[model samples]
Target: MELQQMRYVVAVAETSNFTRAAEQCQVVQSALSHQIARLERELGAKLFERTSRRVRLTSAGEAFLPAARQALDAAERARAEVAAAAGEIRGRLAIGAIPTVVAVDLPAELKQFHLRHREVRISLRSGGSEELIERVQQGTLDVAFLGLPLGVRPKGVHGRELARGDLVAIVAPGHPLADREHVDLHQLSDEPFVDFPPRTAARAQTDEAFAAAGARREVAFEVTTVDFMARLIRQGLGVGMLPAAFVPDVPDLPVLRLRDAPARMEHLIWSRFPPSPAAAAFLSGLGISAA
Candidate 1:
């Protein structure tokens, strides 16, 4: 029933190893085990099934995990609120971003934010736009930089457009269409393409554009990172369509604007509920209106 016991249980469940969980909790393994055992006795149910090889959560533990997390989250939020009332900003801000969002200079912005609010902690995670948006809506992420297709908005979240640009085609110097200043979608329909996997914003935008143009492309390779895509293009594996900013600037690689391509939009997305003070300060620093 004690808060510390709840933390111990959650930690053990997350790590699935008593030794590692005790290490993370900064407690002796025996002490941590004793506290969890005491908690289990109080609850009249075992939380975890301990085996020599691995620790698995019991049904009771599985049922209690979400409530335990919520209790910890609420406690932290209360502490943050008290800190805010005292004119201090100190809390963890979990931010998510899509890979191509490098155009926004996030590291520099986060550095300035950190300098200004040294007590505040920032955690960044990278994922596809869909996954990032889901995390934000689920309250796991404070904010996310998402690459959204035009006119597509995630439900249960508020978004502010940060940047907008068109998707471009990138090719190696020796490629047949490398010299073209502008290429239409249909022109690359039959070309082998190195593309982002489905469910990513870039892939969705590319598919929509090609569908609109009545074109179908052959995807030879699927990659999640823009850097890998750039490498693939440089190796002449296949052509790629990505946000103009994501295409690397190489002497032999050429990026051409796609004719009639849909514009790619980057938005800072957050839950519709009020954000923590630290998250608000970050949004303010970035000149994004959290309202």
Candidate 2:
């Protein structure tokens, strides 16, 4: 019934381990467990089935989860609103971004925002475009930086395009195409490629571009991190295509301009609803109205 108890429950549900939840909540495991146990006693329902190996929510816990989240959200919003009325912006801002983000100097912006709003806490997570958008829409992320194929705007969220640029091919120094100033997709069709996993937004851009250009290429290495992809390219395992702006991150790789390449659009997206005061202030600083 208490907000603290609900918070413990929510944390436990999310982490699925009492120890981990306690760590996340910044409390001792015994205290968190005692609080949750007391809350369950008051409700006359067992909230979780705990074993040494795993912990899972019971039916009652599952049913109570949504209302608990709503209550916590409402309480946090009320607190933030009161703080804002007192001429202070105080809240947590969760931001998500793709690894290839280059449209905005994220670290610089975050440092500036922190200096301006010392009372606000900020956290950042990296994810794919779709996952970041979903987190924003779910209110878990206050804002997100997404990279999607050109002409593909984020659905069910408010987004402002920051920049658009074509992808460039990168090859090892000893590769045959490394000396070329520029090449078309068809010209590199024979080269094995290193790219993101299939079905991801990042991979779709390259896949669609190749299909449109009537070029068939093999993706011999599929990796998650850009660093790994860059390493593979450097070893001559496969050719990699990345945004021109991002090429600087993987230095020493020979970059070849692609005459026919997929264009990526970088965007800042947020929930459609009115943003928290902290988020609004941050957006306003960037000249974006988070209305």
Candidate 3:
């Protein structure tokens, strides 16, 4: 099968929409569909089930997608390697970061890296730490900033510690614990809380701390982003825990250190597999040795 057809399959798998996949691949929808149909015929298995409402991968497509993605990545890496040999650092670098990563000055770092390597393309995605880590392991993200539990390291991913800091409690000025310098997990047991949803590293850290303290908090609001959590806390919806950097600087919003909370360590993680040349260069620019 042609490499371009493999790319089309991967794109359709990712988008789950033929038109969007075609747009992403910079090809016409009919052509992309024709190519995919040819590929399915060649393999004697339908890759996708198409309907008016949605396009979803068939069972065979699910089985084939991972290898297809790996082949695409391998081809891109080969091109990047040749570019590196020619003294050119040119390729796409997909990076992931959690919402609470403001403390790392990521924008400034990326600006500098881009200035130094203008030919490199950078794509940034924001998600929960666990999601970012999963993407890294899946080879979708070249590198990611993850807020892992203290002393906890995920398997099959190489990570370097970027920063370690306490998770602080944020509340409105009139909240009972607002004036406190530090609040223990148990103290907020009965309080209404705003927090990250399950499967997020920040949520995991908070859950572990509360469980260790034998406290069960009432989650009044569950948000996907730190900024939204801050806004909710500021509106007195509920108190929430986040990295200090993620807490807004409003005068009426108070940030108190968590007395018994374990520090969350921000790690720059990547897959154990070899990195693309662009990824390697970006990591090196960040003073990380990806090798």
Cα-based lDDT for every prediction: 0.87, 0.92, 0.86
| Local error of candidate 1 at residue 146 (angstroms) | 0.3
Q: On residues 176-263, what C-alpha lDDT tens digit does candidate 2 reach at each position?
A: 8788998999999999999999878899999999999988999999998899998898888999989999999988999999888799
Ranking by TM-score: 2, 1, 3
| Per-model TM-score on C-alpha atoms | 0.94, 0.94, 0.90
Tell me the lDDT of model 2 at 57: 98
Q: What is candidate 1's CA lDDT for residue 50? A: 88
Tens digits of per-residue lDDT, candidate 3, 1-291, equal 999999999999999999999999999999999999999999999999988999998999999999998898788888889999999988889999987785468889899989988988899999988788789988899999888889888778998888888888878878887778977888888889998888778888888888888888888899998678778887888988877666654445788888796578888898898888888988888888877
Encode model 1's per-residue lDDT on 47-97: one tens digit a residue.
999888999899999998989988887888889889999999998899999
TM-score of 1: 0.94
Deviation from native of the Cα of residue 143 in model 2, angstroms? 0.8
- What lDDT does model 2 reach? 0.92
Candidate 1 ranges with C-alpha deviation above 4 Å? 248-252
Q: Which stretches of candidate 2 lie over 4 Å from their true place?
A: none
The total number of steric clashes, by the backbone 3 Å criterion, in model 2 comes to 0
Worst 10 residues of 3 by lDDT: 243-252
